[model samples]
Structures are given as C-alpha cells and as structure tokens.
Target: MHDEIARLARHVAPRRATRVASAGELAQPVLVVGSTLPVGQLEVIFRRPEVGSVAVQDDAAPTRTGIVTRAGLAAALTGRLGYGRAVLERRPTGAVADWSPLVVEQGTALADVAALAMARTAERRYDDVLVSGPAAWGAASTADVMRAVVAELAERSTHDPLTLLPGRSATWYALRHRCSLVRGGATRVVLVLLDVRDMSRLNAEHGQDAGDAVLAELAARIGAALPAGCEVGRVEGDGFAVLATLPAMDDIQAAASADALRQHVLAHLAAPSDGFDPAAWPALHSAAAWSVAGAADADELVAQAERRLRRERRAAVLV
Candidate 1:
C-alpha cells in the first residue's frame, strides 16, 4: 500500500494554484514606455519602487516591442565610462533592451510559457515573460512562471499517463472525498481492486505491447460495466480500481454487488478484443470492500481490500 496516501489526501494548494490555466493569470501590470526613452531616464524610472519591469515599444515598428528589467538596465549602464555618462545615457532604450524577449499571448497556457522560457539561452532564460494583450501589455516574472510550472507538474503527477486516469495520489484524495460524500449523502462507496494475474507473464510471452493493451482494455471494460456514479483509475500497472456509490446496502448486499461487478469484468476480458488476445490472458482476481458510513479512512479501506486480493480467492500473486 502507498504510504503517501495521508499526505496526498490533504488538499494543499500550490504557491500559484493549479487553477492558473494561462500566462495571463500570472501577469503583473508593467510600465510601458516609448523606445526613444533616454537610457538615463529609464535608469531614473527604475529608482521608483513601483516599476518592476518596463516594456519598450519600437518607435520605428510600433507593433514590435522589447523588455528591460531594472537589473538588465543596470547591467547596461554599469560599463566603464566609454562614452561618458553624458553621451551613453542618452542612447535609445532599445539599444540596451532585450530585443529577443520571450513574448507570449495573454491566453497562452503556463505550461507553454515555461517551455518557451526554459528553451531560451542561459542569458535570457530568466527574463520575464511578456504578455501581449488587446488592452495592455503585462509581464510574468520568470520566478512566477517557474512557480506556475511547478504547480502544473504537481497537478500532472496525480494523473496516469496511458489511461489518463487519476493516479495513486489523486486516487487516495478522491477516495477521501467520496467517503465524506457517502457519510451524509444517499449512498455508500465501495472500492473494488482487480488484479491481472498474468501481466508479467503476458509481457514475457508476447511483448510489452500486448501487456499494455490488456491493461488498457480492462480499464475500458470495467469503466463501461460500472454504473453511472462510479470512477475507475489505474493504481498499479496491472491493477485497476473502481470507486462506486450504490444505494445503501448491507454487507451481504455489498459483497453480492462486488461479485456481480467482478464477474462482469472477467467475462468481458475472457473474450478477445482489439486490445488483447484471449490466448495470452490468464486468471484474474478481484476484491471489494466499503466503509460503513465513512467509519474507515481511505488508507485503511484500501489496505483492507488489497490484503484480500493477495490469495487465489482473488487471483495469483501479483507476479
């Protein structure tokens, strides 16, 4: 059983919440100035604490723009006095601006922003992401962009790759959520664990493709067999689970429901489909359990169900 269930069950919001679907959500209003702004004047503007970054519009090409951070401006002006403060400070801001800025549309997703930001050369990798919008230009700092990336990755970690199902962390979280619902709601939640006994043997006898196809096919079949208010996720490579709420049932009724569902799943898998061959398949076992009005936490219920699935009554050992 996964030890991280308790940790995952707590819903900890990301620094930048997972809801940040686009770069626009991370944007901060920035100062926009004409390209012709004097370098010395730009430096003076940086002195004002309100200005985090400045967007410079190209005078020759109005639609084209560049960005300058206070640090970037300092880097430009701190050079040994070549032309003197008098001559050099007056050069157009564009000369010192990052002409190749990481510009993104306001609607661009944070994942895309992170990709563009990281793909940049090391010098520009930490540059702010410029948001080009209809009304105004905004900036998303590289740090914030990275935070958004972190949140995005965290959200993804809870999901399975091939089945696109909520993975281990997410499964535990949902289990808790459903347990709460069942306590006050008009139903009871049951967890069903199905193990494919021949997974490793299938892979060795056929190939990885066949093994994968079987898991995917079983997931689909189990999902289709379940009632309207149920969810199925891939917890282990060869194991799939279903969390379903049925009309209040006694322990006897619950076990019967579980058996009926299990048999339906096995019957479906016994036949060959586009995903696998019947000849390559072998014994399958399943165990089902539920809490009485949320008496058990998700981890305990899952551990209980997994323990039952270990012997032949459920299926051959996971190998």
Candidate 2:
C-alpha cells in the first residue's frame, strides 16, 4: 500500500501555490514621489497612465510619510494661484495626505491579505495595500486583494483540506453533471457511497494524528483505484463517494462496473501498514445506486444510496 501511494504521488502533478504571495507577481507599478515635489509636478504625475495614488516620501524619513490620491490632489488644487505652488503650501501637509494605507510584508499569506482587504472595504476605505520586502515593493490594489481572496475561497469550497479531494459541494455537482449526461441517453451513471468501519474506534484508541494519517492513506488508495472519468470525493469523515459513468450498457453491465470499483477499493484498503496490526486493517463497506440523467436529481440519487447503505449496515449488525 505504501509503495502504491508513493508511486501515485510521484505521478501526480505538483499543486500550484494558492497564496497572496503569488498575487504580488501580478502587481503593477505604483506612483511614488518626493514630498518636496511641487503641486504642478504632482499633477503631471497623476496624469500619467494607470497612476492612481502617489506615495509621498520625506527626505528625512526612511518610510513613506503619506499618500496623495488623484482626487485629493484635484481638491487641493482648487482655486490655487499657480500650478507651480508647492503641494504643502496649497493644502497643508495633513490636509491632502492620507496618513493611513494598508501595509504588508512580502511573505504575507493570501488568506490574511484577503481578511485585511475585507476589513478595509467594510470601513468604506478603498486604498491599496503597500507590500514591502526583498524583491517586492508595490501597492496591492483592492482589486488584486479581492481577486486573491476569491480564488482562495473557491479552492477551499471545492476541495477537502486534509485529503485534497473534491468536497461535498463539488461531489454533488459532479454527480449532477453525470446524471445530466445519462439523461441525454449517452450512458449510465452510478453513485457509490463507501464507509470505513471502526474508523471512530481507531481514532479513539490511537489519536487524531493517527486517524488523519489513515484517512489520507485511504484517500490516496481510493483515488488510485478509480477508473478514468470517475469522480471521487470525501463526502464526510471516514466516508467517500464516487460518481462513475459506465459505458453504454444495460443494468447488469453498470452494476458490474460499480462492483469492480468497490472490489478494487476494498482490496487496496485491506493491505497492512507499519505500526498497524494486520488484523486491524480498515474494513470498507459500500452501497451503490444507478441513475438515469433525467430521472433524478443529485440529492435524490444520494438519498437512494444512503438508504441502501443504511439497510446494509442494519443487516450486518443483525448477522
């Protein structure tokens, strides 16, 4: 089992980094100028393409002293005698300069960035966050922060954090799609729910860490055994669900396909691992239900499978 998992991991492609750090790579140039620059100079800088806000740096200060936005500059310049006047002379130092801007280090996590950005938005502040570090110095705009946040959320919604397989929502969507294909008279779709027996007992006897390791190993084994075009997801703790589209065939052929998948998973999971007694190898029990595309929705099909699963469990207990 360990060898099989290692082989699968080697063949699996590396996952892309989903942090806010990647968003920095997409950062664009921001406007920055010296505090001594005149109002006319600042006006010209604002006119430049894609320049939104300018960071004002004082010669005596190591960091940015303030920010001058295009709107603030226009307001400050109203009724001014000449464009050559110093910005400070027209609007005063504090009047035109925003003292607060979102600032972050280079390696800030994407999720953290998203949280900060959302807080700022809630307060009706739309200023860009400044990112500073080695090889990174730029402003992350509200758009950039929101984009990263949305991407991170979408990923989290669809994938299980521990197993990295599709979560409940994604699994339901996959089953719905497969059912649609079946309804189009293309092929048969089968939904199979598998439960790991005694998983909770194992966790209680050992620890959560051991249980997590077991779950991860089980996920890998199931993924490796699934046929191409089959979708598998971690539906709940100690339980997995598979949506498979069988070849154009009758009920017997479709049932055969589901049985084959169940056998493959059970066989692989029965293998022993280090530190685990061979007699304690995890046992799996599965129940499958067939569906035609237009006959039932995803929820209905899942309910049918669950009923079958309950019946089987009851029969086992009775025996």
lDDT of candidates 1 onward, in order = 0.74, 0.68
Error of 2 at 311 (Å): 6.5
Which segments of candidate 1 are over 4 A away from where they belong?
A: 1-64, 67-100, 104-144, 160-164, 180-186, 220-229, 249-253, 260-283, 297-300, 307-319
The digit string of per-residue lDDT tens for model 1 on 1-319 reads 1121111112222122345778888898888998998888888899998787899999999988999987787767776664444565989888888877999998998888888899999988898889988999999898888887787677678767677667876777778877776665435567888877767788899898877777776677776765545677888878888776555656666566655655555666666676356687656778877676535467777987888887555334333
What TM-score would each prediction reach against the true structure?
Answer: 0.54, 0.62
What are the clashing pairs of model 2? 20-110, 179-293, 183-293
Measured on C-alpha atoms, candidate 2 has an lDDT of 0.68
Please list the residue runs of candidate 2 whose C-alpha ends up more than 4 Å from where it truly belongs after superposition. Answer: 1-100, 109-124, 147-170, 220-229, 250-252, 264-281, 292-300, 307-319
Say what the RMSD of model 1 is.
Answer: 9.1
User: What lDDT tens digits, residue by residue, belong to model 2 across residues 96-123?
Assistant: 6666767677667766766776787453
Cα RMSD for candidates in order: 9.1, 6.9
RMSD of candidate 2 to true structure, Å: 6.9
Number of the top TM-score candidate: 2
